[model samples]
Target chain A: MKDKIRIASGSGFWGDLQSIPLQQVTKGQIDYLMMDFLAEVTMSIMQKQKKRNPAAGYAKDLIQIMKDILPHIAEKNIKVITNGGGANPMGCVEEIVKCAHKQGIKGLKIGVVTGDDILDSIDNLLKHGAGLDNMESGQKVTDVKERLISANVYFGARPIVEALKKGAQIIITGRTTDTSLTYAPMIHEFKWSWDDWDKLAAGVIAGHILECGGQSSGGNFLGDWRSVPDLAHIGFPIAEAYPNGEFVVTKHENTGGMVSVDTVSEQLMYEIGDPTNYITPECVADFTTINLEQQGKDRVRVFGIKGKPATDLYKVSMAYNDGYTAIGSLTYSWPDALEKAKKADEILRTRLSDLGLKFDEIRTEFLGVNACHGPLASEQNEINEVVLRVGVRSANHHDIEAFGKEIAPLILTGPPSVTGFAGGRPKANEVIAYWPALMPKKLVHPKVEIITT
Target chain B: MSKIKLIDIAHGRSGDKGDAANVGIVAYDDKGYEIIKKHLTTERVKKHFEGICFGKVERFEMPNICALNFLLHNTLGGGGTVSLKHDAQGKTLAAALLKMEIEI
Candidate 1:
């Protein structure tokens, strides 16, 4: 069995509150504190940052938060693990190492996981027969080969264990599965074997339970969302796990957010698919087998997890250049909101078609009228103003370039009272579409780098 | 050959006896239900489950969902303490059965 360590989660999304991580370590008993910071669009935004300044690609805010909680972390010797590494994990660690050294801390090793970003080698791999097709769209990688900003295959807990084995106090990785950030430390501390499926499943379950940071601890409880306590000061969750594959998901005493079966179930179902064979790089855990109950104040004990060997193939997330798309929106007022919106879209389409411009897709969505609920959306006849959002995508820059002319004309010609086009002409933007494919484990490897700034 | 199907219809739903990993098979509607039920009686499910488990398979029926929850035992061949752990990103038992086909 691996060493017994407590793993705690702090951040869920990029915009998560900052005070939570500090509170988690200060108030709870934990050996590792994890924070997640990447989302789909976050990659593109970071890519833009890297373009302007190569050192700016990782989550820079990690610097500020680490400063806030470092003393407590250092005092408690809490090992901090986070995917705030984004496209530049080494950059993140350098900042941490510099900060740690400033505080007169010696021998604090920070390890970084890299090689997930295979942007340059994409073409060579594609020529060798990596189709890297879109799982949702059924389009091949060749469809959008020129526009990809970032492509990272999610590495699970193995690199994390590798880091812990190196005796690092802090670990940062790029684009790992969110839960893997939590699972890796457990494996390292416990020294769990590769084929020991049940313990792996339990760790996976603990990661899932705490992956969303505060969600499991009560930040976004669906049952009477109004009734969840003190969300403003919500307590981030900590996994007090035992060597027996048993764990308690709880928060520091007297902290915000409620921990209950209902809240945990809601979080469990979020973005979830099959539970029985929940596949990860480590083991395939059966979420259905999880037995959770309130053990005491502010704690839910999870047990009865089942797992099997992991698959030989790893799911690779490849982003390719789809096409350039630009959206321009204009609003038309009350009496003829929908009608004017339709006119605006038709006028834009007509002008673009007249210009003989071609695109892979030219789409329009009525924001207030029926965009959210989609096909089953209700007709909002009473809406005072409707925003007409028209976007187009195409490999030909010239074709998508014509969209700039088509959208602005709608303000003066197509719809009366058509205003709200604040950003001037719509500039073409490269669409980074997701491509889910499989790669043999042998072909892909994760590299670790430690930089002291 | 039919394409194997998998779904986790019971995460925290009832018919979940403690100590068992509860999973509901879609059975692919009523017709599929008939076929799967034929092959997966509690005894048969237990037999199939036990062969892999070296443990136990506690079963429960949820006719409303038209599925069954099978709690697996000696899973991970004695809990997770034995192996390196990972986050199971969107995997389930039903997915396992869908991929793992055994002709009875």
Candidate 2:
């Protein structure tokens, strides 16, 4: 069994920096490069793309990243794992195969882990007594069944580990938990058993820390932002995993970001609800039980993570077409900018109300002032500029489109010194609402397929 | 005791889970954690974010890491793709919440 393995993080989400994977492959020694490209709403977007063009559902950036790093990857024998496959893992794998062939690299075994995309099976499952009720609102699937864009079960690290066992050099998945990509390498390399909750939990925490790429390694750090060095060439995070459910969060040598106790701790707490029961498809990790200590420069040792047995149900991420939303912004300058912005908002709303256009939700924000903090923002006495931003959400796209038209008119009719109307007209965008649900584990099984080029 | 920002003693980061936004504040030291524990109540947090978060604010204690996580419900407008606000996901909510003053 391997005593230690280094897994480097590449991409955080779908649109993250593409060069990150290449840097990790060429600049450092890593057993696996895990790129997380899927987000909560990414599946729905990918589904829409697939409907428009069957060959274009998966993350296209993955192919480019593979092409850039395939040469080094083949030379170093570094395995690549990612959920960049999005809605179509098979399509993503085929693209990778073509990339390998173009690069003159032969006999590349790429594994595609699928069966997570259940958009087509939602009706069959509903017939089989799978209610798939919204976990948050307790609403039935029938409430938005007609509008569902995508529905996928969150798969765990098991299938990826199985792919590794089968000698697959590159693994692509659909709707797999972001953490699974990082932990699957550890589980396979160290020969960690399925029931090893503590080790698996440690791996899960590592994955969490690495999932966001540079976020845990100093990029976008809220603490002492100025103190974090060389963010221009920020080094992505790497986990030096050991067999005893312990790892050190570090970065590549000569790299930019700092990997201290604070950074790792903050990441451990990001987007987490109920620290005692951080649930994944494979295990329930207790975030509160994690222990961190700075071992050396840019190295924080993480250990003593506790976890419970795997849950019987897998969390389902479903997105449906809720409505249309349009946002319009106009900047007001100098001599009481806050007042001018407020006046503009009032006038715009009055016009919308006067036109007999009803909206499900109409919201406004003073960009330079309370755009972020809202009521928590301090009262502004005088401001140089404040962007008057208004957005409306409604079922009728025509109403939203009309609302978009009203913003440019406000510059001449209502608010004075209005500028920054660079974008001509605010376009109506389709709103993809998220639906969280749970499905029985036995009902869905992950399918892994390996292709060689 | 003088009024001081939460950032004076602690630092935090916030992100969204659907419509809910969670801000995890970690103290610079054990003393700072104690100060936050006594002063940073869920009621206080909810009140501090009066118009921003229209729902309940639940705080969870993490004594081991000397951190407190506040989950603000029904915030973020509508979250992710649905929300029209500039800070739809509440990514900057932590920095904003840190502006809250406490008697130290």
Candidate 3:
């Protein structure tokens, strides 16, 4: 009531249960419904969609949800912000407008923020000396350029904020930071000036805390997870941020899950590279100034979040063609199944050598033993059937394809009790590389166009 | 020479307490689990966690879980928008603890 606003994240990922968003809108008194759709793989899948159909890139489920929640959203004046724009925001808006028209909503405004995905600009950018260095390896972008799959700049809340300033009802963006959806509502509602670093950072911090949905509200908590209440009905946290940079973390009254000072603090400490300099395009949030305390049973008071002027540069996420990779598998029955799998792996390697094809890397893992553990897996007994997965990555697509063909031949030639091969021939898929770089913030000027039905 | 077991720092998580770094250490059992205390001494821990850390390390023990919290300094790799591009593997201020290799 006192210059406060509520922002809630309904879905953490695509295919999340729809009832959460419905409950947030209907029961949580949420001012905004923010949905996150893009994962690392999500962009690739969306790219495939855009390749097949011009108007199909955004999250497909949004259209269905819009139809169901049309009456409630329109009646409550609740705005929705999502990065559901897989590869295209314009196409997403067009569909939303169509859905609105069918629902007989007269004044629904749709806004699209594009230009974050610049796969076509890679060559030009490289020519201009944007090395797009790998953060881990310090390698040049060219190392993975030809094999790139998806590249997207992580836009912050500026575009979404601009959309709100334009009075756009629903904002769709491509590859905006996960926290920006919640932060946009706070900035739009409070009219947070761009220079209000402390307030902005507070909002960003709040957004970051709750961005992963129930993770901040005790759902995915590693702390005493078993007693974390009904995880199936876990409540997502809402950040009620104010102009003074103080916010309260809370959830719906009867919702399942916990939101205490500790939960919020734990989430705040997650994925943080630096605390004092939580850098963002909009503002430089100082995580040190953050003060969290338990205000009530299901509420945490977040305060003292300080911030500074944001740097001129914005982080760019450009995916490039890194290399060609092929995965071939075989099943070896027990009583030397592991040995059989190992033999198949050696056979494939020898075949690749005979073909004189070299790859950057090759790895073989016995799935029943330890895939996640890798080298750390303890020695276990041979299983009934061992699944041998052989993976190779290289610049040679033909060689990779050839490696795929070697697996099926193993049944006739190499190993015994070889079954469990179901898939078709292996193919060369584009390798979407990750290029993390900082560009001047001035480069990205957001355009919010409201398509009224 | 004593070998520290995996039960020592199994549940450790770090945070800041004013200017100092406080590492919360929980031993595996309810008692003073020798593996954790053997390696997590203030002097030895300080040696195992140098260069990677910019601040002092304060230690504490917890019940119910074997965990420790160590706070480091200016970890966000100079926090701000600039640090977002840097991948510190979520170590940030606790770089020293990580560099010293505390395994589960």
Candidate 4:
């Protein structure tokens, strides 16, 4: 078994820094480059793209990054894994083959992991007694099946492990869990047992640390932001995994940003509801058992993670067309700016009410004051300026559009000293509402295929 | 001893799951964790975010890591791609949460 292997994170989500993958390959000696490009709602956007053009659902940016770093990774024998496959893994792999062929790189094998997408099978699954009820709202799938744009079950690392075993140099998946991309390499290299809960949990924690790219480093760090240096050149996180299930979280040698116990701890808590029951497909990791120590500068060793067997179900992320929403804002300057903004909001709401435009929801925020904290903001009488932002959501398109038109009128008729409306009228946008559900693992299966050009 | 903002003694990160916003508050030290455990109750946090969070606040304790996670249900207006707010994902909620004052 390999003593240790370094897995470097490139992108946290789609539209993350483009130069990040290049830096991971050029600046560091990593065995695997893991890029997570999918979010819970990204599949819906990709599905829309696929509806417009069947060959264009995947992350097009991944092809460009592969073009930039393909030759270097090929030379170093560094494998690549990503969930950028989105709605089309085959189409994404076809593009990557063309890129590699154009660059004269030979014998490169790419693995395509699919079958996570279940948009087409929603009706069949529903008929098969899979209610797919909303885990949060207790609503059935039939409630929004007509408007569903995307529905995909989140696959875990088993298919990825199979792909690695088949000698796939690059693995592209549809809706795999983000943590699996980093842990699959550890599972493959160390030959870790599938039932080894502690080792698997340790690997899961390592994946979580590196999953956010620079967040585990210092880019979005909230702890002593001033102390985190050179965010412009911030280094993405790297997990050096050992056979014993202990790993070191660090960044590139010359790159900026920190990898301390505090940073890792903060990331461990990001987006997680429960600390002990951090669930994945392979195992249920207990983050409370994790132990961290700052071994050296820009390096924190993590160990002692425990886990239980995974549940019998998989979480499914589905999105449907809810309604239309448009938001417009106007900045009111000093000399009772807060009061002026409040007055403007009242005027706009009164106009909407007069027009008899019914809306599902209408929200207003006074920036430079309580926009973030709401009632928790400390009162300030001497504020220089405040931006009055108003948004409306409704099933009627004309209502949201009319609300958009109301903002421009307010600049001239409602409040004085109003500016910062240079973006023109806020256009109505289709609201893609998320519906979280679960499906029995036996109902859906993942497929893995390794291809070489 | 002095009264200080939570940001002085603890660091936090917040993100959204559906319409719920979760803030994970990690103390800098054991004493800081004790201070947070005593003062930063679910009621206090819900009150601290009055008018923003419409649902109940559930706090989960992680004494192993000296952290407390607060899940404010139905807090993101609508959350994700549907929410028209600038901070739809509640990324800035953590910074706002740290503005709470506590005695040490």
The DockQ for candidate 3, computed on C-alphas, is 0.07
Candidate 3 lDDT for residue A162 = 82
Each prediction's DockQ?
A: 0.03, 0.82, 0.07, 0.75
**Model 2 DockQ class:** high
| Each prediction's whole-model lDDT (CA) | 0.68, 0.91, 0.68, 0.91
Q: Please state the error at residue A22 of candidate 1 in Å.
A: 2.3
User: Candidate 2 on A1-453: residue-level lDDT in tens?
Assistant: 877999999999988987889999878789999999988999999999988998989999888899999999899999999999999889888888988998899998898999998888998887776669999879888999998999999999999999999999999999999999999999899988889998899999999999999999998887888999998888999999999989999989888989998888889888999999999987999998988999999999998899999989999999999889998999999988888888888888888999999899998888888889877777768778988888899999999989988989887898688898888999999999999999888888999988999
* Better by TM-score, candidate 4 or 1: 4
Residue-level lDDT tens digits of model 4 in A3-90 = 8999999999999999999999999799999999998889999999989999989999999999999999999999999999999999
Looking at model 1 chain A, report the run of 10 residues with the lowest lDDT sum. Answer: A369-378
lDDT of 3 by residue, B1-104 (tens): 44444423333334332223344443434344455655566666666545434555545432222334445454332222112112222223332243344332
The collision pairs in model 2 are none
- Superposed model 1: Cα runs more than 4 Å off: A1-5, A40-52, A119-149, A219-221, A449-453, B1-104
Residue A295, model 3, lDDT = 84
Cα-based lDDT at residue A337, candidate 1: 87
TM-score ranking, high to low: 2, 4, 3, 1
> i-RMS values of the candidates, in order?
15.5, 0.9, 10.7, 1.2
The lDDT, on a scale of 0 to 1, for candidate 4 is 0.91
The deviation in Å at residue B42 for candidate 4 is 1.9
